[model samples]
Target: MTAVQQPLAPHEREMIRDELLRSLTKLERSLKSSGAAARPRDLEQDTVGRLSRVEALQNAGFTKNLEAREKAQLEQILSALRRLEDGSYGACNGCGAPIPFERLQIFPETLACGTCARG
Candidate 1:
C-alpha cells in the first residue's frame, strides 16, 4: 500500500539538493583522477609489486564504477531541478498527475511516480 506523504520542509529539500551536488562533484573528481598504473616494472620485486598494483587497480576500478553510477543519479537529480525550474517537478513524467511527496523525499531524482515507474 502507498504511504501518505508529507511535503518537504525547505531545510529538508535543501539538504537533499546539497547531497546531490556533493555527489556530482565527487564523481567528477573521480573521473578525472590519474589512473592506476603507468607501466609495470620488470624488477626483482615483481611478484609483490604486481600484486599490490593489481589490488590498487581493482579498487580503482570499483571506485570508478561506483562514481559513474552516482554521476548518472546526479544527472537525474539535475533533471528534477530543471523540472522544478519549469514548475513541473512534482508531476509524473509519464502521466499528468502529482508525484507523492514521500516518494520524492526518498528518491528526489525519480522522474516517474510509483505507478508509472512500476510499468
Candidate 2:
C-alpha cells in the first residue's frame, strides 16, 4: 500500500536541492579529471607488451561505461533541480501525486512515487 504524502517543508526542499547540487558539482569535477585517463593510449609508440595494451583497452572501456553512468546521473540531478524550480519537486511525474518525504529524503532526484514505480 502507498502512503499519502504531505507537502514538503521549504527547509526540506532546500536541503535536498543543496545535496543534489553538491553531488552534481563533485561528479562533474571527477568526470573531468577522469576523462584523460579514459582515452586510448598511444599503443603504437609505447613499448608495452600486447597483454598490457589489451589491459589498458579494457580499463578504458570500463571507464567509458562509468562516465556514461555518471552523465546520466548528472542529467537526472539537473532535471530534479528544474522540477524544483517549477513547483513540481517532491511530486511523482507518473501520477501527479506528492511523493513521500522519506523517499525524497533518500532519493532527491526521484520522479515517480513508490506505487507508480512498482507498476
Q: Which runs in model 1 stand beyond 4 Å of their true positions?
A: 1-48
- After superposition, the stretches of candidate 2 with alpha carbons farther than 4 Å from their true spots are 1-6
10-86 in candidate 2: lDDT tens per residue? 89888998989998999899799779789767887369888988888899999999999989999999998887787
- What's the C-alpha lDDT at position 6 in model 2? 58
Q: In candidate 1, where is summed lDDT lowest over 10 consecutive residues?
A: 34-43
Please provide, for model 1 over 13-108, each residue's C-alpha lDDT reduced to its tens digit, 9 standing for 90 to 100: 676567656766775666555233222334456456777867766766776677567667757867866665555666676775767767877777
Models 1 onward score TM values of 0.62, 0.88
- The total of clashing pairs for model 2 equals 0
